[model samples]
Target: MTRRALGRRYLSAWIGFSAGGRFSQALATVILMFAFGQPTVQALVGSAGTWAVLVTLVVLGGLSLLGQRYRIEWHGVLPLSLLAFVGYCALSVLWSEYSWVALREFAATLGFIGLGLYLALGRDLVQVIRASGDAFRILLVVALGLEVLSGLVLDVPIPGFGIRGDIAYGGPIQGIGGTRNFMGFVAAMALVTFVVEFLTRSVTAWRAVASTALAVIALMLVQSPITGLAMIALAVTALALWALRHAQPRTRPVVNGVLGVFVMVVAVVAVLAHSRILAEIGAAGGSASRLALWSQLRVLIEQHPVQGWGWVGTWPSEPVVPFDVVLAPSGLPFTSALNAFVDAWLQIGLAGMLILLGTAVLAFARAWVTATTFPGVAYVWPAAVLVLLAVTSTAESYLLHGAGLMVFTAVLVIAARRRSWRGRLPR
Candidate 1:
């Protein structure tokens, strides 16, 4: 093949294997399926595939060096973020209530960070973002479709028919906690992509109808109405601020005013909805069980405030399920849990909180700027992340190793790079 053809083939292959590729999504699907007991070995293979993406990035980085033709524009605070994470992990190992467990968490966290860094910094950011976004759209469609079918058709004697906690969420949709919020989060992001693309691309009647239908369908399926509710507020607020700062003076006030109204409305709705959750929480004496277990976390941090828990092991010890109330009776490691932030802070202390905050500010700030420059790039991932931080803080703890942080980091870095490219290219 000619040099041009070789280069084209290489580009295709790179895009195909990157974070957003079909292979990656397939791996994710397989993992979830395995969690549902599709096959132990198959699940393990899927797990290996996740790692393989990380390995590919390392190998790709080496290849780029050999070709001597690669360039990275913005390093994007990743190294500092990763380094701080390492320090926090070390602290956890030293002070962890569950020392051995914390150690495993530490190792797992390190591996996850390593994988994300390889993809975010080394691979082609644009391709990854586009591919990942596309893959997410596909996943949303497939997941929602499966959810409907399983609910309507496969409900009988179906073993592992719903979310088994394999790949974040799968199988039949559990009520509030059973992948409802999780899939809602994914759909919220998809809505953002749809809107952003609609703004830039041709908004044909069919396209508009399809997007409107999908958005409504996702809202219905997610049932966690607040998820989409949050996105609307964030997008309006983020964009209005951006426009005020960067748009022409004549257009600025108008854009800001319109977005301002949109935001105010969203805020009012969110406040009312949040009040309901808080009311329920208060009436029930708070997410106390989660709070109680989480309170031990505070004790752990206070003991090692600077680096409260030892990083390498799970130091703090408590009964796995102290609470009498049962949420998911069948789910293993069941507890009254809500958010990742609380767990991290409890496990790692103020320092860990700072690290997480710093990571978010740096990553989100970059993404915000990018979104501002190319409004088309503005999407729900950032908004979804904001809600994830809030919701997960209330229920679960998986940001470091789970799909949440990985997808969030991958999208933010790629968005930053794409914004940079748009800046350089001639209009």
Candidate 2:
């Protein structure tokens, strides 16, 4: 064949692969794997791995999106809240003191968002949950296996990947997540996914049970105070969802109202009893460290209280102003403000922070309503997952630009597609 014909032939074949049904499911799995494994890949393979995965998936996801473009509802397809959040982040480049950093970070953010969009839009709700369960299951298992090797047999720390090799001592093991708390957070998320899978009949009962066990074991080993808080929130949300699902249709309004007041009461009590809660969860020291970090961040945020330093999604490894101004209690530079909201306020300012919070608030409201009213157990998954993410973000900065952001995007798309008013318009 002539070179032109050969090139055309390859293009057609690529298009076919991208549009395949099986390929879409596989893409969802891989996107999550990459999202969750990013820290591990960065630890072991360096920045090149990050770029390679980002670039390859960006090109591939974009092509796949194009191939199946006709299937998606083009009229009001994108979630406006999420779109606005991202747009605000992108606009930060205009006034960013570190223009190059802003540009670089925005590119990475787009890459994550693109993959998340593909995962959400390419498949149905059950498929996304299955993909999530599978990713968490695989990562948790691998993490445990490595902890065994490093902590049991080898008895040495894998510093490069941040595996502390303390499993033998009953772990606060970092695993592949780069930190004990992060692994705990992921495992807690896994527990939420696995429980939903069981309730929805997405997986066999045995499989669900096993997955839940694995997640629980991992969570215990990590012993993260932040994750303890997440578990409590998840447990409460799960009970609330269970009650909502079983309530009589006509009486659900009363149930919802009561639940709303209960949630408020709990919040007020939590604030009043924070010292006891912190001690119970063993978070007093971690809480103190975080408060210190937040205090420093507050001083920095005051400099450009309205506009912010710029949208560097994750802090630079090398110290820079604002980010450089704050250090961990360990006397090292902290990667995040350790709180997603504070990070948002520091990077994008008050307006951007409001937009971000608005986006999450709308998403959770929509998701909670869907869970109560929607027929399937799968409807509850997004609501419960959002609870975990929201509660976890108060203590950690996971919801920004990596696995957490991708997860937030996927669920936002899922819940929004069903509950968004835009869906009411004629296509």
Candidate 3:
């Protein structure tokens, strides 16, 4: 074949991959789990291996975008609010205390945004959701397989990774993921995806059941409190959305209004009675620790409330805010504010926090509206996922990195799509 023909073939493959083809989906599954999975693959092959995987995916994604003649449509194809938030993050590099770190994180953020945009623009919502589900299925299987090997056959913790077989106390199984909480988070997401797939009849009943069973089993073994709460929140939100979807059109506005009011009231009450509530839930110690950290973080925020210290993708190795002075006595490994909102404030200041909050509020609102009125079962997944993210973000800084950032981008893309396309979706 001619060089041009070869380029065309390569482009076709990249596009297929972006559209959630089997090969691309498999690669994505690994990429998503790489960092969390104790850096298992990274330990063997070294950082070079991880870099190679990332570079390959990035190149394929870039080729896919070029093949589509993709254009960045900030207002139409993408949400302006999200763009504003990301732009602020990039711009913060100027005022950031750690400019180099900020720059690196900014680049990574852009890369994730690009990947999300490629998936959203190149394929319909159904295809993206299905592709994500497939990726999750693979991750779930791999994680569980590793856990079985570690707990049964090998009968020892994975070498070099420090993954232990804590079969007692519901396991605390790290699986391939580095931390039990991270594994639980992945499993929770997989459970949500599989549930959606089954509800929509997108997969064979047996396959759906098996996938969900694996996810649930993984989640149980990991025993992450945050994921457990998130699972419940997701279930409640999904059921409510289903009910709203079936309600009369005219009643939706009224029902939504009532629900909004109810949620606000509950939020206010929770804030007022937070201490007692935390005590009741047996989370007083954890909540107190978070409060102490928040207090210290607040002092730092006030120092530069408008501009912030800088956006480090992950927590800095060194003390950026005298956290060591305040939190050292507690002996808590408090790397983050334990909340995405607070973390955003600490990293980019109050203005950045508002932008992040605004982006989330608008995206969730749009997703909720579309899911209820879009006339298809598949529309519900984004809304459900958003709810789960929101719940998780309260206690974990899941945003601004890896799977969290991708999900955030996907929601924005789904929310921005034209309503006219709803009719084109499969029933």
Best by TM-score: 2
Query: What's the residue-level lDDT of 185 in candidate 3?
Result: 77
Worst 10 residues of 2 by lDDT: 318-327
Worst 10 residues of 1 by lDDT: 32-41
Kindly report which residue stretches of model 1 are placed more than 4 angstroms away from their true locations once superposed: 1-69, 74-79, 94-100, 122-126, 157-178, 202-212, 225-229, 238-246, 249-303, 311-332, 335-337, 373-398, 411-427
**How large an RMSD does model 3 have?**
4.3
lDDT of 2 by residue, 286-360 (tens): 888888888888888999998888999989876577677677766888899889999999999999999999999
Q: All models: lDDT?
A: 0.49, 0.88, 0.74
lDDT of 3 at 366: 82
Tens-place lDDT digits, model 1, residues 301-343: 5655665444422222234222222233244343323556655
In the predicted model 2, the residue pairs found to clash are none
Q: What is the TM-score of each candidate against the true structure?
A: 0.63, 0.97, 0.86
Evaluate model 1: give its TM-score: 0.63
RMSD after CA superposition, every candidate:
8.1, 1.3, 4.3
What is the full ranking by lDDT, best candidate first?
2, 3, 1
Candidate 3 structure quality by residue, lDDT tens digits, 1-427: 9999999898777665554555445444444454334256656676567656656666666665555454533335667788898888888889876677678768767766766776676556776767777777877777777777777777788766547867544587886666776677788888888888898888999999999898888988886767877887776787689779989998999989988897789789979998897777556876777787888888888888888877765575555543444464556556567889988998888999999999898888888988989888888888888888898888878776666887788777878675323435454
Give the distance in Å from residue 262's predicted Cα in candidate 3 to where it truly belongs.
Answer: 2.4
